[model samples]
Target: MKTALENVHDWNFEINYNTVTAVVEFSIHFVSTEQYPLLEYLLTNGTKSLLLLPDDWKLYEEHLSDNEYRYYLGGCIRAFDIDTLIEILSSNFPCIYSRLKKNSIDALLHHDQQAIHGPARLIGEPDRYRFLNCILNAKKQLKSS
Candidate 1:
């Protein structure tokens, strides 16, 4: 995967594994300024999964400046065992499972209620919560498995 990403002239990536914790971190960097939109899209859409926990999206949003575009994207997954980590990485779509923060879990519950009763009225909170929940649950399940 690193080789595949590096093949793109505008893109570079690194994969780091922590042996003691059995965690893998995948980080991608975009070299071309023109690729900022693509970077934003990946961060916004790719991170929207129920099987992966929220990482630094919020921090990124808060700190991003108009003149300074953040060109890096990264995610970490903790595996219950080496075999599980290998299995996740070998699959078409790898993921993680981790417990949701209190606020995030609360938002998810609220979103569920709104979904069953009526449409979510907030502009982007619902989507954010949904994505966060997906990632957290995925991480949690991964750890248990």
Candidate 2:
């Protein structure tokens, strides 16, 4: 079996929030950094590559507070060098989640679907759901699940 880090490498993902079905479906493929500009930029920015969801790009711009957004960007740039997996909009970081006490992975999924008017993609699934759950809540996502 592949190590967690190894598994994360060969991934390209898509997310569909079925407005009609009121459901979500997400899938991943073995895509290289060539398939994503952010990944490419991370590699070129003196880091290997930072794995994050597509919707995160939007959240990076829409963080509930200016401090949160600034801190998030600073942290991500540093973490990217270490190959950390980030689900920014997912409010899935344990530290961020614990502070906010908004815990629920399912809710994070809802925000993802609603991002940009009904569908957003993660750079890839998080290494852990608990972490993502925290980030979503910290980001002020209102999804109940």
Candidate 3:
């Protein structure tokens, strides 16, 4: 399935256990067949998060309600392991971390940052739970320690 974010590039997730900070850094080919110039973004786990759109794109609120936009945008964040994310959110937002499991992770980050409706496509699901077990097991080890 070709998602609104079909041309996803390298995406890296970094977790700072000590600082309780998680950063999702990634790049995407917003424009088809583009080279050298890619749309890069850095999303941190916090209130004043960011949704840096490409220079040619416009930002609006309606985009927030778009499924394709949400599917692509939310999928980027949702692409992370759900369980580990729950654990991470649990530590930071103890009261509402449960909602993370029940809801879209992207909603937590870029819900109301933009107002314009943009195009988004459907993304395929290929091993969405990439590091779920490893992270969860690591957390288990840490708790045991």
> Which is the winner by TM-score between candidate 2 and candidate 3?
3
Model 3 lDDT per residue over 15-132, tens place: 2222132322222322222121222332223442233332334211122222322112111233244343544333332211001111344543543333112233212222223333
Per lDDT, the best of the predicted structures is 1
TM-score per candidate: 0.32, 0.20, 0.26
Evaluate model 3: give its TM-score: 0.26
RMSD vs true structure, all candidates = 13.6, 19.2, 13.4
Candidate 2 structure, TM-score to reference: 0.20
What are the per-residue Cα lDDT tens digits for candidate 1 across 1-145?
Answer: 1222211234443345544554555555543322222111122122232232325762232123443344555666435333443433433443322222334544456444422221111113333344344444556655675
All candidates' lDDT scores? Answer: 0.37, 0.28, 0.29
* Top candidate by TM-score: 1
Clashes of 1: 11
Stretches of candidate 1 off by over 4 Å are: 1-10, 35-54, 57-70, 80-145
Question: Could you tell me the lDDT of residue 21 within candidate 3?
Answer: 27
Q: Alpha-carbon error at 135 in model 3, in Å?
A: 1.7
